[model samples]
Target: MGRKLQRIVEAAIIERIGPVTAQDLMAMSDDSWGLIRDQITDRRNGKDGLVARCLACECEVYIRTSKTRGIARPLFQHYNGSDPDCPWFQGRNIKPDAARAAQYQGKQESNFHRLMCELVGELAALDSRYIKHTVGQYRSPTENEHGRYPDTYVEWDDFGPFVVEFQMSGTFQTEISARCKHYEREGIPLLWILFGLDTATALPQSFIDVIRRHRGNAFVLDQAAVAASREQKTLVLSCYLRKPDGRLDAPKLVRFDALTVPRSKIPYHEDRIVGSRLAEIEKVRRPWFNALAQWEDRYKPLRDLARPQSLLLAAAFSIVAATNGKGRNYASEHSNISAMLNTYLSTKVLSPYSDLLKQIIENTRSSSIIKASVHDHLRRYRDAIQATNESPEWILLRKLLPEALDPVLREELAYLDALPDWANPTSE
Candidate 1:
């Protein structure tokens, strides 16, 4: 909002993270909306935090923090369109009235990071080779004139060593330079998660350029979309994308590979759906919901826990909505907790807490906890599906709308069709 902040966010984009061009960096962040939204539906009942991994270097780091705390770090969040270089990334400049929306986003992201941290922890706890962390900050330096703090220092493993500071967005020129100096002078392997949240706002490539300007071990984390650093690497794309025709042509596949070119590119873009898929989604909701409803009845009766009771009720409604009053499951049915979790895990968005889930199942005292968790997660799927009236699974389902009598029925009809017909709901 202020000139000082503008400059800092801009400078940090390029200084701390490299490979992103100045145009990209400048196009990144935008004006703040109102307060961010904080109400998160944490189906996982998991902790919140940030996860960073380097496949090239075979290193990983995880840190947890509250939503508000998470938002304060000045990374590239949704775009209010401070930079007009890109219009595709930004839906519209909604920040003027987005305080509430932003607040919700911040909170949701907090939950997201929390679960991610949990997954990372579970991963590291599983394998000693991985460096999982519960990053706790003892002291945070005062904000500079632009309200940016120096590279964050967290309380890590040893009493006084190996804590990480994530230069989230707008690369930190000073921080990177200082990091290089620190490396030369103190040899600290500063683990930086050069990340961005591209919604309406995408970070400018300039941010990474700034980071590169700094001479240090500050290897740039792969930006989303631009591919996974040649090959055999890890990347954090906002939401995975496929071809417009849903026909992964060879060149498109090659282009997709190119998107992951060197470690220096982040071409994160919104997913573009192709043809009659949306119509097909509406077509399938009925049967899919029917199966889901049947399963909920079967599963809820067996749940036998207070936590699960609430979840069961919510899921029942969702299934009812999808069944649309039913008949089939689809291949893309993701309206279940396990399904959604599978989606994220399969896509490499979040590491799976599969082991943790198994652990919860085994924990003698936490059976109710596990049951409730499973139920709650499934309920979230139902609720999201119902609220949007998108389709059977509401998530993957999509189609063109037909003329309808009223908004309510229209919504339900649309949603019913969204259910995938071949998910084989009986499997899990």
Candidate 2:
């Protein structure tokens, strides 16, 4: 048999508010349950406090906290007795899976979930285009073929239904794949909401896998934002996206009233705009780009090199190359390039001509090009400069070099300049 009925209860509660393991409850404060008290009550003196109303039977219920002897953590219990048909009512013959069929079956929803659901429904109702659409908890038919009950189902005017699943527990890859297939077969688009944590922390592998299945890198909803939305009586969702390199882009607050119903199954298309804005902001604020700009600003007078715009170009090229020409992998590539460039700047010999060659090497390495490939460019540039002293490209490159090593550095910068606009730092 499974562990015990208590284990199921603990799993149910943890599934509602997680990123915290069952063992971590000892560290949780009393206020962790503060948000859920209005729905759940303490069963003291057999009748002192108000009881939670069962979702299925409307019977009174009470929650047991960690203070209860023998109980591990907080769990809901029927005050009088649970209805026979209620999912939370644990019958002597009930199977483990049957007892835990639905995540919120026996328990009252946390305030966060209830408030968010209300706000989301209100926002959907406010849309003029979808004013006629119905938004509420989707109760799958008792004989439902798929056995799927989405947290919130939205019926659009012209588009298909959108199913929102609020994920608070660890999700397995197999489960995610199965759900994706099930929803696709049912002709419903699915949206996942990740609750309780900031994206700066490493996401659960299950959460990441689910997002991947949805063709998204991340789907986050900040609890604080949801609470604020409840207070403002407006729907505001804090969306945090994970880039390809595994860093979260800046969080974007999307107003529910401003959401547009897409022709496709997926409703929200704001991630692309949010990602583009983040990229624009990162162009100037990226650590590697900032480092390059600072280095150029300090050393540009040493040699008559191009302005800091060249460094920006180089930074962009590095990001593009690192992401396999996608140009959107700045988050991880920025750190990688910054480390490599810092090492080169600190250790390399500093003649103006050599510095330019070093910068090119830094760019190549940042792009993840093999050392042998870089050496080929180095050899070709040296050979061509030696063969033709008055080559136009070589003459132009020599102007950027120090007078001391005019002939020594040899048109390497010229070779770099001859490449496409993306490769040349000075080309913009």
Candidate 3:
């Protein structure tokens, strides 16, 4: 939604419960989102009134509806301002005498080297470009020195040599200077994107004079412009060229930052709450199943597979599987619920995996992820794990299963076991 439609959108849409509209917001990663313009809630009777287009770019948006389909895509795309000096390019025409240009390119290349060293765990270091973060000083470290690589980058898509350095929120001059020097010495090309909440990076004349002294190109990323680029998904794997004067133009933007949420946020609680916040999540998420059940209704015809639903289901599970004094007691005393809830409000609201709230329950019963936290999320789905530990279902589920009963749903089995003698899974 844009500045004008903000209030109107607030009025029209009902989240996670009714028919989702073209204007609703969709989760990108845990950190960001892209709004849908002309969203296609349903493609009815061989014709279409549902269309999602990006407001900034005015591009059409689409989503994949099939639970068991291939290549499902959301229709909104976040606009990342174009990279006037991104590291992906090989440099159009190298001039032998343009030594400064070569030096800048080297800085870009070295920065890519550093970025990959950081991103290596999850993404491919092909062309050996990725970002590595560290204390602004002291001994430097590389990703390789750490351990096994990251799962997302290793298994899924690849990485590019260009690394994006978000100098927003925390770009202390000292830290910036140190990081820049590190890369400069590394002789890699870097896309130094800088910005503040108020606007894009327009380096001061003094700053430009300083950059002119450097061997690299720095660009600024415009958050507002990027937020407006919701044509297909909430975000993109792209970067932008910030005007040195810190001004932003809507059209010449780049979309970047795919997989905005880390794998860590996954295996999250599917069913968090049934309150207003949850309702808002649903209004944007609402897309009813064929059974005529509201998207929020638990008894829809199909099994719960949406990521959002899965998260809720996981929370319901935690209500039973909880134990006292065991895990992150994000909620314990009623006073604490506010803090925990706030965390969700701040983080879960914009997370792409938040959608996993729908698909999480299904994933919990799955073998795709082997981490115990997945079980933990499901274990304490209702409240905090530690709080729910004493839940009736938790005790019973543990009693019914053998030591580690993962193959068959140990939780479900426990529920069945807790039933009276007349009722059992065998009865099914």
Alpha-carbon runs more than 4 Å astray in model 1: 1-98, 101-132, 139-164, 175-185, 197-206, 210-428
lDDT of each: 0.30, 0.45, 0.30
In terms of TM-score, how similar is model 3 to the real structure? 0.22
Candidate 3 weakest ten by summed lDDT: 5-14
**Model 2 error, position 269 (Å):** 9.8
- Model 3 error, position 166 (Å): 1.3
lDDT assessment of candidate 1: 0.30
How far residue 73's Cα lies from its native spot in candidate 1, in Å, is 32
Off by over 4 Å in 3: 1-162, 195-428
Q: Write the per-residue lDDT of candidate 1 for residues 304-326, one digit (tens) a residue.
A: 33333323323333322333323
Q: What would the per-residue lDDT of candidate 2 be over residues 123-220, giving only the tens digit for each residue?
A: 55544445333334444643457556566666656554566666655546666666555665566766667654445467677776554443343455
RMSD of each: 25.7, 14.6, 25.7
Give me the candidate number with maximum TM-score: 2
